[model samples]
Target chain A: MAVFTRGFGGHHPEADRPLPPGQHLTADFPVLSAGPTPNVDAARWELTVRTESGAEHRWDWAGLQAMPAEDVTVDIHCVTRWSKHDTRWRGVPVDAFFEDVETAADFVVAHSYGGYTTNVPLDDLLDGRAWVAYEYEGDPLEPVHGGPVRLLVPHLYFWKSAKWLRGLTLHEHDEPGFWEQNGYHLYGDPWSEQRYS
Target chain B: MNTWHVAQVVAVGRLTSTARTLTLAVPGFAGAVAGQHVDLRLTAPDGYQAVRSYSLARVGRDEVVELAVDRVDDGEVSTYLVDVAEVGDRMEVRGPLGGFFVWHPDDVGPVQLVAGGSGVVPLAAMVRARATSGSPAPFRLLCSVRSPADAFWADELSAPDGVATTWVYTREAPPGVTRPVGRLSAADVDAHVIPPGERARVFVCGPTGFVESAAALLLDAGHDPARIRTERFGGT
Candidate 1:
């Protein structure tokens, strides 16, 4: 049972804008990272996707830019209890990257330039659910906000959207990534309030 | 293993105009290491709950924990913690979290702590722990605040402990201070921080902008990226 804190009338979200449990609405986008930002030049950037069978699909910066891009505005909820609504982003959907690849794997481990990684289910990356976002609010994503490119799985808690994304490896078994290993929920879904494991 | 423990505020102290320290007593509380934080959850009379993470300002197995909270503008949880909450207030706390940013007394090599504003809370804990444990490891702290009045634990940090302390005032400095008031520059970091050649384990904590700029400065000064750890609380 939770203790009631006296004189603590919490901030109430606007009735029209419903947020996930335990989440408060924030007007500002907050950057949360465990290490220093990695300076990734677009010219040298490459994203690779490896399957359980060891086959790999690679895309350099130009290659990614040549693909069909999308402009999406969606709500993003961070595990840290702040939710920002209608964030604008431009990216190639994750499904496009996997269109030609064959994978029997059920999970993926996203790799980032700064040695950060996050796990997500394969199902979450398809059907317009996720993207490799490179632009935000009509501007090139700033390095502090995971420049060059970052994974964008809006349905899950924002941490699952790894920053400075480098590659993805498919796995038959679920493997906990950086924050997951550090006590965060493995399959973080904001709506369910799966914040900590 | 995240378990919520009921903690009662045992004491409260004013740190500055915008910040306060809350000492909580929790039964069966296993101690935490310096630099770890806790998720404090407050429930209202209507059962509406809000949770916020705060770094432990004091660490031990004494069943009592300390948290230093700096009120952010229009911040609901912080406003309550800094102003309305009383000594008898009760809340749910989970953690001693984040292993990557913690400091251990047994750690070898010089430790450099860089803090911005309220980010100094955990670093202060490490400094206190170092003193209490009588750790011989050299420690240095570089703190940036808006002014002398905004610095948390100002008197304690100003007094000579084993750690070498430097201050950068972005808005106002002390009366006799010769340094100009401004944002921390790379030159300031170069002059006060430990040189990269010594391989000091660097820990930088602050608002996102401060952490990014400080970490960049450290990197520009040739510090190894792996050796420098950072924790950023989001804000401009």
Candidate 2:
């Protein structure tokens, strides 16, 4: 048996700064998904916000690009330990998309290609907290990395940012997403370590 | 309640220059199945903590579990487990996690395992379980690595058994191998793996890119998407 004499691996100098509990600073982005990556054609890509009463608000690739887009830099945390700080994204804010719409639903279920689904509170998606981002670091998102478009909800765990996002289904009640249904917490807050139900 | 449990390192063995295998004596271990993984937590003296998940390379009778960790450059927890943590060190762990991506001895038909790099850990556990349980089910493993030196469990996997082992070297092959160094082509997969008509249950584990390619190849080869189970690690 090899005896380890060195102490716990040296800490990052940035360890003193506030970070989500159980997370470590990582310069590399780790890609994790439950299934195969869906290749969505940009021309056919569309994002729809369907209300409970059967109202559909749709945005095609051109329409979404024509909307007001904002560049955001924010810290993103994953349920997994890696945390990448100051990620730059360009997209249409959720508030701008919903500004003219009226919805009585309290929860939103994000639907993605390849049958992935996750639910978020209506409040979390509003107030400039979330975006339907199509670009990362100024390049069009790659397909394997959820290109064309993806939901970016910075306040919650990265899983909340559904990849290959196709539509948002507004619901009157809360429902767990793919991971949430599989033992993850309904509301994943990295700081609170709400990883599991 | 999936809370952290204390695990003491009982032994350590180097598998490769960048990888080490740790044997842990986890008190109250509930006997994890093959292909399941555990989350290990390391806390610094200054109160900072890091957590990472590693597949159980081997599961023993209560109180014992093994994990093979490959140190990723700039990886916080992998560096600790593979290089720093010594025998007798204690760490917090939560697991036997993941019900999917597991194989049971009693499962019907042949089992096909496709692994890339260090993703062989959990599949190795399944191989061990099949041998220990004395199941006669046919098993095949198609592993992709950079070289013979990078492959883990060479001795055990090479042992003659119902499990047919094949290696696809992306960079370098063993001394006398005639095959060129390259990725697993469609022809290689079709020739080495069990045909889809045999109704083999396929489990592929690796980084996202490897898994995506492998699963797509399997689908292209006519395997039912429902029968192919995949588990991806976070890497290029």
- The DockQ leader among the candidates is 1
| lDDT of candidate 2 over A1-197, digit per residue (tens) | 22222367555546546888777777767787766666689999998888888888998999998999999998999887778888899999998778766889999999998778999998999999999999998999877668889999988999999999999988999988888887788999888988788
TM-score quality measure for candidate 2: 0.90
DockQ of each: 0.73, 0.30
User: For candidate 1, what is the DockQ-based docking class?
Assistant: medium
Model 2 regions more than 4 Å off = A1-6, A99-102, B104-106, B134-138, B196-201, B219-228, B234-236
Number of the top candidate by lDDT?
A: 1
Best by TM-score: 1
Q: Report the lDDT tens digits of candidate 1 across residue range A93-172.
A: 99999999898999999999989999999999999999999999999999988998999999999999999999999999
Flag regions of model 1 displaced more than 4 Å: A15-17
Per residue, candidate 2 scores C-alpha lDDT tens digits across B1-236 of 38677888999999988999999887777768898888887766765566788899976566687999999877777888887888889887787777667887788579999999998999999999898889888899999999999999887887886489999999999988888998877987898999999988888888877998988888788887767778887754
Model 2 DockQ class: acceptable
Error of 2 at A62 (Å): 1.8
